[model samples]
Target: MVDTPAPGTVRPGGRTARVRETVLRTAGDLLAQGGFEALDLAEIARRAGVGKTTVYRRWGTPGTLAADLLDDMATQSVPRADTGSIEEDLRANAHLVVKTLTEPRQGRLFKALIAASLCDEQAAEALHRFYATRIEEWAGCVTDAVQRGELPDGTDAQRVIAAVSAPLYYTLLNTGDPLTEADADRAAKAALAAARAGTWSTAAPRGRPTPNCDN
Candidate 1:
């Protein structure tokens, strides 16, 4: 007798993965074209050539599907830059963010995801997880800089990393300003300056140290 795989344990590159890829691609295409409201499971199954039941069973709802897509994106995101100098690493990170947000399809997809997150609790959680993953990946750069004495001791690595991308995101979301390579460089430089100036330090306050309570 042939053995059947467990319900949720399909091997990588197997039939399940292929189905998932097709459905996600179709979903992404629809999202880029018409945002979150355009996501319909029946239409997704039709476009992906998968069974409607399969799509529904796997993803359940539009919000859940969007959350799954974000999870996939986080998994597939590029690793952080590890250049010797923190400035170079941060510049690379800023440039990458600009490149992603400026790409036509990806930009639209991101906008749709952000919109979905605004209206859907599940999508919001997934969006938060996505950023957390990306931030943790890049935090290594700050830690390395601190170890090399380029940044002061007690620097908050995640804060420094967040600083690098904050302005770029603001440009993308808040202002209608075009994100240029120069802007990317300037963001990285500004974050590096602040980090070097101890803006993100986690050290004790300047006034005094805590008194030892144990007697």
Candidate 2:
């Protein structure tokens, strides 16, 4: 009963797309303003000017609505950078995270979504998928670096990319520290250093051909 269309099934500029956009927009606004506890399907339908029955039929629960929102967010997320330098690419990734986390509306929206994931299994799975998508997208930076001989051949691209964001999330969720551009730069630099030191390199026991870092 998810509102999101199946892959390759959504038509551009159609009524279904319009309905989804309106409903998701209203849902995001509600989450940002009042958090997950305040997201009501009936209110979303009313605010979006869509039929309650349509909302109820397509997205049966708050968790499904939140999961759908996360799906949309992942689909619309920014593409990774290709600056020909691993440092620059990682910095770009880190800065983008900081920008999203520092923006008032987006910051609150993400917090609300994280809260929803903490309490709802459906939302949690969607949240995990969202991060996985983002990480996989950015992992290209590391793989490209490896191809260009900028990183060790066995470096784990996804792990390196995750390293760039882990500290930022820790600050956001635990440290109560204000995230700044400096923090982003430092994070990227630390990840780059660790990557260069082969911290994420996969070890091949004894004599097996080393697996491709891009794998």
Give one digit per residue, the lDDT tens place, for model 2 in 86-157: 999999999999999999999999999999999999899999999999999999999999999899889999
Which stretches in model 2 have alpha-carbon errors above 4 Å?
A: 1-13, 204-215
**TM-scores of all models?**
0.89, 0.89
Clashing pairs in 1: none
Clashes of 2: 0
True-structure Cα RMSD, model 1:
4.1
Q: What is the alpha-carbon lDDT for the whole of candidate 2? A: 0.92
RMSD of 2: 5.4
